[model samples]
Target: MSEASNPVVEGSLRERAARRLPSHTFSDLLVPVSSALDLAEGHAAGHAQRVTYIATSLGIALGLDAPTQLACNYAGLMHDIGVVPAGAGLGAYTRGDERMVFASLPLLSPEEAAVGASDSPEIVIERIVDHVIHGARTAREFGLPAETIKGISAHHEHWDGTGYPHGLKGEDIPILGRIICLADHIESMIDQAGPLLGRRNLPLWLNQLSGIEADPNLVSVLRDLASGDQFWLGLFSADLPGEISLGCSRLREPKGMRLLGFSESLSQLVDSRFSFTVGVSARVARYSEALGRAVSLPDLRLKQLRIAALLHDLGQVSVSERIMAKPGILSVEELEVLRNHPAYSRDVVAGIYGLEEVADWVAAHHERMDGRGYPDGRAGNEIPFEARILAVADAYVAMTSDRPHRPRADDADAQQRLRGAAGSQLDGDLVEIFLRQVVS
Candidate 1:
């Protein structure tokens, strides 16, 4: 579907997000999202956080202004945002496999090479480059600073002009991109090696690829920063997110609506992971808002509900595409893994400030009034009222939307299914309100 006609891209939700973005810090808003992105790529927690720390520190040490430093910080957090959509074309390669392929680009392990043996090198490079291209587009759509978008676009470009998508050489790469490139590599090293060993070897590693892989000037700045034991200690600290936020205190905060757009953009990215599920979150949010208004929920409560609806499936990123796209019933183990996503969603959202209540509602989206949910078995009013509304909206959208395993139910059939499940699999009143008011 054309983006302009897509319900998710409609302006009403963007207005709502705009209205809510001003009160929170940009870091507070994006750190949870960074964690979610990490989950999508199958990386351990804190990769983005560490990258943000390293890139921002390098920006500051290099005498960048506050705005540039903030861009560096955000670009670091969201550099790989394209990976979700890019994974769609990478056949049979798990997110972990994709990561390995990208990390060892222009070189592949025997197994990695075997997976794509039939594909030409140009095709593989194009697929790998797709992530950065989509990432830059997403960053722009979210109304990020121009420099931030450019940095994301060029983060993978090598100084020697061998990168994919575009191979601009030397100073052709944005400085912020150069800093992030170095930071991204350094963070990977730290993740592969323990912090102590990573720190010890960083100087040698930087010297070996100083001009080929990254900007030599940025490498020198990082080398100087690495000399201080305190830098490594701070980066590996348990409260790395907090430290990054504190360090960024002097930078300008993003306006409220931009942060909201960022959240909406992320929800779209999550939905893009599977073709059948495209726009599911947006539809759910639309229905949930309609239901919330019908119930006369307070404005603040409605806003919270909207945000939760957009992000309710944030944990779905943890599920493998193979399982999600399975044309038949999932095995019991696979089903269990699928069922655990809400808990993963909760853990990721709870890390964001002021979203604790939203996190709880998101976690309970699958709970039935009859206590049949997998993650939690709260029945009757035990489930949060907001979550009950979310459940009805989710059920309606899922039924009406096509899935790999089933055709889309017609409106009449979907309504009947909602009515049938009312009071058992779903809250009866919310279902009635949804069908009678919202659906009508």
Candidate 2:
């Protein structure tokens, strides 16, 4: 598209500078355009877009100056840029994911990166939040402004003075940060549950939260909007695009391969992080990658799939080393624990960053095609392709490799079992693809 056709906000600040400002004026471009790009990690994937949207709304609502509004707009978009994802099984999820979206993405330069360089007091707090808080000092590595850093660092402080990391009381919170706290929480609750209260009395629900989790004034504003038909119409119009998300499939295949390698590394780390029954993790990692590639699955997808495959059996780690190491049949409790691991893995993975997108697949690896699977008993399309592939690979590897609980089944026996289970216990097409490769 031509320059005139471009949305003014869409282009890099540097590019926009050349067209709209004096050609050689470097002062206007405070930060490099590339750094801005680095500030958002896969922006389309999560709430960062909505957070920016609402923060803009809040800026307009507060009637801030153009410069401050523009700064807030960019800062809000990148506020959570320092989240360091350690994925489920070894970590947990929180409102922090919003912070990390901007915090953790690789930046263009260390010296001037938004997460770097702060010889100032304002930078001191920002440094504490982004790095010491998450284990990576992004604000120090990037030259983020003090005000911008302070706004993000304090976005979580409560109006009631009970907030974390710093017990800053109400009004003590920076205006921009307080507004962000307002916007972030409002968006979070709606996203977690439905925007509207479930079949209950609407006023009762909105009324209950007014003084509790939500700020009263903000709630009042929302209340007015919710009570009116025009607001409802506006909301309905906003959602007309149908919010089903789109993943970047253009490089998904290649990225999946890279992730496959990363998953192998991760799996190896996990295996080493705790005790393990055998050294079969390498084999598992390799074949999962092979299986994914064999099916024409992209590497990014395969990486997610490989993560599932690597960690799916981790719940078995909890089943008592004695039971896991025992050659005999397990007791009822042991069997129940074993049965629950598929779901347990999901919970474990959901807490970690970089792993949010893959948790369900890991959780659903044992689900049968006929919906007879454990955990949530999901089936068909509900069972992601990653789970399907991992299930087949797990079965193949488990059947052919000796487990502490059982001896290995031969290749022939494993093949027969897979073939027999197709369309019932296993995804038929996946099994077919797997066997075809193994046989040939």
Candidate 3:
């Protein structure tokens, strides 16, 4: 994973991000991509959403206008987008969760926490200081506004001048950055606290960071916002992402090709998290779209099919690499966890606006046509045709590509096995169509 940081765009990240309007809103693309980042840690599920809510609400409380508030909201959602892959990789080799180390390293002095004291100092420094830089770049790539990109780049800056990748102190830090810093830390505290207790101790949690960690002015705003029951209610609500989606205009634009590019970017990032799964999504996407065309699917349906193919395996990030790379057969328990990835993938995609249908197809990709699949037993027509196409594409890619347990399959052998499973394990007609396309 590259720990390189993007130089802050001179004018605005938001302007750069808005240069192109994709088929869907930026968040529609970003929320699912954020899922991959959120899943990088074992304990941080939904952390991005919660932080975004807190930051945006704080932005509102601070009397920022709706556009600036929306920018803050985008900043919150993607603040840590760059940290996950490298953080996950670092943690895998370190003694414990390196996320905590990365978060706290900025605050600690040289003797207290030597940055390079651990294994692989170069990579460690890159992970620590460059996340915000890379995050800004990602937002730029995703076409977010300049303010949003700057906020993402500066979210980790400390009030006391100790933060990394340019530690501007006090009021010098961008206001959006300051808001997100508070939101990001507060969310971490709430996560660290058990759910029931976290809500109860919100005041204490806010107080802990007032002076050194967060800007005191923003902390005051957060305190005011925290006083309202509606604030907490909204934060914990099942529809928080929906509520957030309604407020942000930048995330609502409909640009089909940009949305497709958004999915491709996310798939590449997700694929990078695993050593073996690189390029799997792209191949599946190509095959799935070709199969869709061969079957004479409409253009809109073809786009949805492609998006689903790109994101089909995002949930696997949550599964342990150990289990995924195991050379032998998995135990029943391990297998169960692995099989639940599609459900996870569905939840991730569904959280984004306008991708709910695509989420359904992603969830159904693992289902068997004969009612024998693991996650859901939907049989035959019960599975969406798009999903059936996805299943065949994913399965073929898996078989033909190298696996930890077996060498890549020859085309004839792969086709024979796929043919054997057609009616029962896959959709027979789709399989036939797909095979014909491949042969041609």
Backbone Cα, N, C clashes tallied per candidate: 3, 35, 15
Cα-based RMSD of candidate 3: 9.6
lDDT for each residue of candidate 3 in 1-440, tens digit (9 for 90 to 100): 22234344533664554443335666665655565567654546677888888987887777787667767877877887776455535544444445555545333532333243456556566666666787788778777889999898888788898786797899889989888888878877777776678778978877878878799888888788878788888888887766767767544434453777778887887777556688999999999999998998877788888989999998887776567766799999889989999998998888766678989999999999889995888989999889999999999989988877889999988898899999999999888887878644
Q: After superposition, how far is residue 18 of candidate 3 from its true place, in Å?
A: 26
Per-prediction TM-score: 0.88, 0.41, 0.82
Q: Report the CA-based lDDT of candidate 1 relative to the real structure.
A: 0.81
Model 2 whole-model lDDT (C-alpha atoms) = 0.52
Best by lDDT: 1
Task: Give the TM-score comparing model 1 with the true structure, all chains together.
Answer: 0.88
* Candidates sorted by lDDT, best first: 1, 3, 2
Q: Can you write out model 1's per-residue Cα lDDT over 76-182, one digit (the tens) per residue?
A: 98888887887674545433344444444323322354355324445555567787898898888776789999999998888998765688789999888888888
What lDDT does each candidate get? Answer: 0.81, 0.52, 0.76
TM-score of 3: 0.82
Q: What is the clash count of model 2?
A: 35
Better of 2 and 3 by lDDT: 3
Badly placed stretches (over 4 Å) of model 2 are 1-266, 269-276
